[model samples]
Structure formats: C-alpha cells, structure tokens
Target: MNSLTIALDVMGGDKGPHITINAAILAINKEPRLHLFLCGDKSIITKYLLEHHIREHPQLTIIPTTETVAMDEKPSSALRNKRDSSMRKALDLVEQGKAQACVSAGNTGALFAMAYCVLKTLPGVERPALISALPTHKENKNVFMLDLGANVFCEANILYQFGLMGSVIAEQVDGITKPRVALLNMGEEDIKGSDHIKLAATKLSANKYINYVGFIEGNDIFTNKTDVIVCDGFVGNVALKTCEGVAQLVYRKLDRFLSEHFFARIIGKMLAPALKKLFKSMNPDQYNGASLIGLRGIVVKSHGNASAKAFEAAIFEAIKEVEQQVPEKITIALEQGLIEETHTE
Candidate 1:
C-alpha cells in the first residue's frame, strides 16, 4: 500500500471492463494504499463495479468516456478519430497529474501512437521504446530488453538511448547495478549486425555509466551473460515472440506427453509438486506486463487475452514502476550522462 494512483483503461481488454475491473479490484485488495482511476464508458464500468460491490469504493474513481480504440484500428485513425477513447483518457490522467501511471490491454499500435502524442518522450529521448522484463536465466531475475516494435527502424542514437533507458529500468526495478548490456548480433564479433547496432555498441562501450558487453548472439538472450539487450524494434519483437512461442510449445508437448504415456503420467504425479513450482515460475502470466519505457510517464501494456490473475500481475508491474519512480530515475540518469547523438541528424 503506497500513496499512488494508477489509471486503467477498463474498456480496452479482450474481455472489456470485466477483466480490467476485476484486476483493479484484485490489485486494490492486495495493495491497500493503492487507488485506481478506472476510465471507460461510465454506465458499463459502473455496472460492473456495482456488481462487484465497489461502485462507491473510496479507493476507486471512474472517469467517464464514450469510445475505445479498436484492436484492428489504424494508428492514424486511433490518434485522430478517437479523442475520447478510454485508452487515451487513461493516459490523459497521468499527463494531467491525476495518476502516477496508466495500464491498458488495448491496441499496441494505438497505445504507442497515443502515448507519444499525449505524454511525449522524456528529455534527451529521441523516441519511446517498448520494453519488457523478461524472465531469464536465474529464478526471480529478469532482463529488460527494449525497442520491442515501438520503432521498426531505429537509428544508432535511438539504439543508444535504449541502452540508457534499459539501464535505468534494470537498475531501478530489477535491482541490477551496472547491468550488463549487449547488442544483439548474428555473431559475437564486432563484424556482426547492421551498422546501426555496431555504432550503438561503440557508443555504449565508450559510455562509463553503462556496462556494455559488446555483441551477443541470440542464444545468449536467455543466459545470465547479460541483463539488458539492445536492438531495433524488428529484432527485439521477433526474439520476444520466438521465445514465447517456444515456451508455449514446450509446455504443450510436456502436457501431451504426460497425458498420452501412462508411465510418464505416473512419474509426473510423483514429480507434480516440483513440476508445479517449475510451471509457476515459467508461466507467461507471471510476466504479463510490458513497460513502454522512455516516456515521460509510466505506461504498461498487458497481454490482450490476459485473465484476471494475469492482468493483476500487470497492475502490480505498474505499481512497482510507480513506486520506484522509474521515469524520474531515467531523467536523472540522462541528466547525469546524456550521451552525444553520434548518428547523422
């Protein structure tokens, strides 16, 4: 329980206000000091809140709005057409200093588009990047990788900015001091990746504030070798999806194998306790929130299909970022050591 309020776009998720409202209840229950501004269609959201016996709860506030950004809506249309959307209004709460952060399980492109147009980037940030705290090599540890499809085409300076922003998140949230950062590459040598990555690696290496570990191949992403991996949106998004896909495949195959084979089922029952722990640790729901870092205010994107439990995890992520004041940490880090943009203007 902390003295912070979080804005939630209750209309944006796959299940609409049901999931988001439930998540708001779950989060507020868990954190007694937390307050929520649940922004969306007032009548609908209020109905759900009343059904849940929370319509007049002191900790929750409902901001009335009429429209929502469609999942398939073009970014241009969302930005221009939907001025009063729940997603936009939730962000507006933070921009107007009514809330500390905003969380939405809405259109990705629209969120990115709206957030930038609304909050703008922090000082010295060329652009905001999509970052996620991915569960990595060690238990309870995560790697903050960025530019996760926020900008498909990033310049060398933009990539460098990712390292700085990633560094702040890793240090502030993950508690990793001087987090080991690396440039994703086809090979471990300097003669790898596009010129953008190479140039970014060079700049990061020269910066004393960051612990740049040169280039690491794709496999190294899951290893303990690095805490932050910098790359353009195209590569980061592909790597993120590929890893999630493989994880889902492994879980499915294990379940099928256990069910199909009698011997394995017996063994699985015996190992059920340990296997359960493993499964919980590897659950994608545990990592449901992905921070759209580098913005002036905090904004988290939740998985569209997230359940109440999964969406609760995302709310907690927003809470942690707010409690830690991650955006402020990034600002201080930039002011202390704003690297020169070496790439061509």
Candidate 2:
C-alpha cells in the first residue's frame, strides 16, 4: 500500500494538542499507511506524545510552530500576523508537497484565508467551498452539501460552479453515477428565489453533464431526494447548524421522556443498545470533517469542539480525498464544463 502523509494543526482546535495529538495517534494506528506531521509548539506536543509512550514512533513527526491561530481570530489578522502559526504551517506542508492533505479544527475564517493564500485555487475555481456528507433517510446512504460557510455569498456563476463541484464529489467520492444536483432555495418553483438562483438553475438544467434536479427546500435535505445540494455559505452554514441543534434536541427529549417514570425507565434500559446506535448515527461528531474543495491541495476542516474520535474522522477524511485525487477531478470537470459553456454561448 502507498503511504500517505497528512499534517495536523495540533494547536488550533479548542482543546489544542490534547485532542489533535490523540487523534493523530489514533489515525496512525488504524491506517498503517498514514504518516502525520503534528504542527504546533514542540513542548506541548512532546508532552502529549510522552504520555501516550509513542514519542519516537516512525509514523509521527513534529513540525514545531511558534504560534497558534486563536478561535476568534479575524481572518485578516490571522493571515497577516500568524505566518508561523500551527494552522499556517500545516497548510504550508501541503503547499510544499510534504503532505498530500491537512486537517484542522481551527478558526474557519482564518483557515480558509491561510489556505487560499497558500495553496490557491485550481485553474478554473474562483473560490473554494466547504463540503461534507450528511446521513440521509435511506439506510447506509448519504448526501453531500457544499458552501458550508466558506463564502458569505456567491454570484450566479459561482453558485453554478458549486453545483458542478458538488456533482463531481458525489460521482467520484461517493460513487454515485450522474448524481442528481439541486439548488437550496425558499421554494422549488422555477420562479421563486433571487434572480441569481434562478439563473444558476437555468445554467445547471442546461448542462448535459449534470443531472440537475431543480430546487429543493430545506426540509428535503436529508430525504435522499437529491445527491448534491448547492447553496451560499450563509444558508448552508445555518442549515448544518440547525441539523446539529435538532439532533441534540431529539436525543435530549427522548432521554428525558424515557427516564420520567419507572416503567419508561425500564423500557429505556431495554432499548438502550438500539437507542444508542440510533443516536450514534444522528451525532454530528461522526460527521465532523468538511472538505474545502476546489483548492490545489486537499484540506478537511473539523468541527471546533471536536473530540479526539471526531478529529480522527477528519484525518481519515483527508486521507480519502488524497487517495481519490479530488482536486484533479474538480479541475477537469470545471475545465470541461467551461469549454462547453463557451461553445454554447
């Protein structure tokens, strides 16, 4: 098997090196082909590795960084001031070809800024978008959503590009042939939504390479009705956070109701195993990583408050993208789509 190198911004997340170091250890152990460069303060990372007794493991390497990007740091501040930060160095590794991909649970804005500044976008990509898979209604099936807070707003052309990007992810990463693509809007009607959205829809529908399914409302996101859902960062971010909130509410309400009475508690105990499995499927932690697509290199962003297991999932997410050559695929798709558009015009 071919070995893969990934860089982790150990000091960028909420729990700092504590969570990322453990996740690195977990990833290296589970995937023998993985070699991780832990980018952060050497002293802190050394302490964690010592605690785990794998300080000198061949699969692990430390890339000492003097600074760390704070969770609340502004994008401009981080980009201009934190050059040697753990987050910046991790991205640098990818840019330098020392690592095929990088994963971080850091400031979203800062990471995006550093990544864009460092790796730049593929030839035809204007801006990168955050994308990740979500569990759908069908068993063992998932749907991909894009623009999860990568940009505040996008024009019609950008949104049209997002649909193309999302379709490639669904087809190449998820192995869905000619995946159905939809625009997330207020209504499914052709005349609804802003003019840009309508324009994007018209462009998508006309693309023979894309299987455009028209617009879908928020309620249908998890219904497996569409393989790819494209929207601006504002709406996608809100929809993602809303799903997380609703999942937590459901678990809390179910647990409280089950423990309210003696008979109910007994029933809960009886259903504990199944209930645990159900909640596990719904947990946002399992889906912690969101890939920033359209860049020259691969980057997977973990949730800020991700636990060790959650962050480990992010590392593996990067690994998958590396193996899949996602950036190359996106470039080809965009280039082909652009040529087609030019001919039509």
Best-fitting candidate, scored by TM-score: 2
lDDT of 1 by residue, 1-345 (tens): 459899999998678888988889988888889999989999998899889876498789889998999888999899999999999999999999999999999988899999999999999898899888666768777777887878888989888889989988889987888899888889998887788888888788878788889898888876778999888999988888777677678777887899899999998688778665655444443356788988889999888777888788888988899889999999988876564333312
lDDT of 2 by residue, 60-149 (tens): 889999998999999999999999999999999999999999999999999999999999999888889998888888987888998989
Question: TM-score for all predictions?
Answer: 0.94, 0.96
lDDT of 1 at 24: 91
* Candidate 2: regions farther than 4 A off: 273-286
Structure candidate 1, residue pairs in collision? none
Q: Return the TM-score for candidate 1, rounded to 2 decimals.
A: 0.94
Cα distance off (Å), candidate 1, residue 61: 0.8
